[model samples]
Target: MHIFEGFLPSPWWQVWFAISIPVIMYGIYQMNKLVSQRREIVPLLAVAGAFIFVLSSLKLPSVTGSSSHPTGTGMAAILFGPAVTSVLSVIVLLYQSLFLAHGGLTTLGANVFSMGIAGPFVAYALYKVASKAGMNFYLNVFLATAIADWVTYVVTSLQLALAFPFEGSVFASFKMFALVFATTQVPLAIMEGALTALIMKYVVQVKSDVLVGLNVLTSSAATKLREAME
Candidate 1:
């Protein structure tokens, strides 16, 4: 969800920008490192960008008298790893801002922090933890998307609260956010989780080569697939 324009007062807005500049620079640095390490990932990044572009453009009705869309960050994170996914998301968000204005320039950093950084990273972390615990892969994928998608909105809602402080009523702001956003977000999370799992399964089976190119499918995973086919 977009933070409405002019939501923040001047001083806090200035602080937000100040904090964000270094984060943006760090993202750029990380992107450059990933490109160097995995030269083939450049094309995949473009593909991921296009996928997110399409996903973000599709709007679903929200209870808040607005619409929202999937960021598709969980899939990206599962594909390229979270560090690279952050950069991927920043690029996609930039493109969306320039073309679609789905998100605003002034609030761009906050959006990046919420949707780009929090969403994919949180999901990937969940996947890793679940995998380590010997949880089923599909279940891990589902939990990843659900938690990430839910947390993204939580972060966004908190940001909105920070940006627009109500008159001495913090709980009021939180209640408003929960009422308006949670209904649509819950269903969207389930959809994103299922979609991510399907896509990942397809890639691991029919398009193992693509995952190899993305540097996501380990040699062991590839070998297991080939052996199973044999």
Candidate 2:
């Protein structure tokens, strides 16, 4: 959920900017280094960015009272890790803030932290854990993506609580926002996870080798998916 233009006040907005910049700088380095070494991955990067744009852009204000849209960061996080996913998220956020008026530049830092950094980091971590556990490929994607989606909103609610605690109780404010967000976010997360998994399945069919090379899919898993498709 976007915080909207100019919604966040002074230090809070600045503080979020402070928190997000260094990581994004690192992400810039990672992205540049990766592109320099393997320009072939450019199209995949575009696809990842497109996923962020399209899925996140479908903003549903509230379903029985919720907040925003599907973050679509999970697939990108799986494809590029949190660092590079952060880069893609900021790009999309910037575009939306400028032209789409979804979020403001002032709140970009906060938005990025929730939708980009925290969410993607969680997704990447869960994806790695599931991969190491030898979980089924699509199932791993589903769980990681869905949990990441929830975590993003959880973080968003936390941010809001921190900024404006209810009666000096951050936890109480967090509960209020989180409960409201959950109404729509729960279903949104599940839908996003399923959609991400479906997209990944098709991607595996056409670009299994590329995914394998990127370590997104184990060679064995890629082969199995290919065989299943055939």
Candidate 3:
């Protein structure tokens, strides 16, 4: 879901742009490293971006100036990191704004923050945490991906609340915006999680060696994930 053009108002929109610019720059640097050193990673990046574009394009009317949809950043975050995924998201968002007319150019920074930075960071962090906890590999992916989708909406609601506090209450506005998204987002999150897990499982089976060779997965982790998928 994107924050529509001009709905964010003045300093708020500018502030988000300011915050997002540095991250986008860093993400570009990160991606440059891969594009230069590990050219093989480009295909994986394309797949991840495709997942984001295809899944997020499915929109449902949720609130004024916004809509509900599955944010497909999780797999990218899982494959690369949040920073790299942020760059991917900027590309996807820019395309949607220009061609699909789904999100607006004015609100791209806000949309990127919620869907790209915050959400993917949460997913990557959760995946790390779940791995450390000795959780099942696919289950960890499912949980991380699902929770990332939910976190994106929560951050979006917070952004909205900050811009337009209800009766001088940001918390109240946050609650309101969150509730509006909750109806559709909850189920979408589960479906996204399942979908991501399935795709990752297939990758583990087909690309296990490549993942290890690229250091995206350690030999041991790759073996475990492959067996777990089986």
Off by over 4 Å in 2: 40-47, 58-68
Clashing pairs in 1: none
For 35-127, candidate 3 gives per-residue lDDT tens digits of 899787788887768777887777644433345566788878887788899999999998888877877787999999998999999999999
Top-TM-score structure, candidate number = 2
**Comparing 2 and 3 on TM-score, the stronger one:** 2
**What residue pairs clash in candidate 3, if any at all?**
none
**Per-residue error (Å), model 1, residue 188:** 1.1
By TM-score, how accurate is candidate 3?
Answer: 0.87
Q: Number of clashes in model 2?
A: 0
TM-score of 1: 0.83
Candidate 1 weakest lDDT stretch, 10 residues: 59-68
| Whole-model lDDT per candidate | 0.74, 0.87, 0.84
Give the Å shift of residue 67 in candidate 2. 9.3
User: lDDT per residue, candidate 1, 74-146, as tens digits?
Assistant: 8777776777777777778778878886676777777777787878888888887777786766667778987
Query: Which of the predicted structures, 1 or 3, would earn the higher lDDT when compared with the native?
Result: 3
Q: Where in model 1 is the C-alpha error above 4 Å? A: 59-68, 212-230
C-alpha RMSD for every candidate: 3.2, 2.5, 3.5
TM-score of each: 0.83, 0.90, 0.87
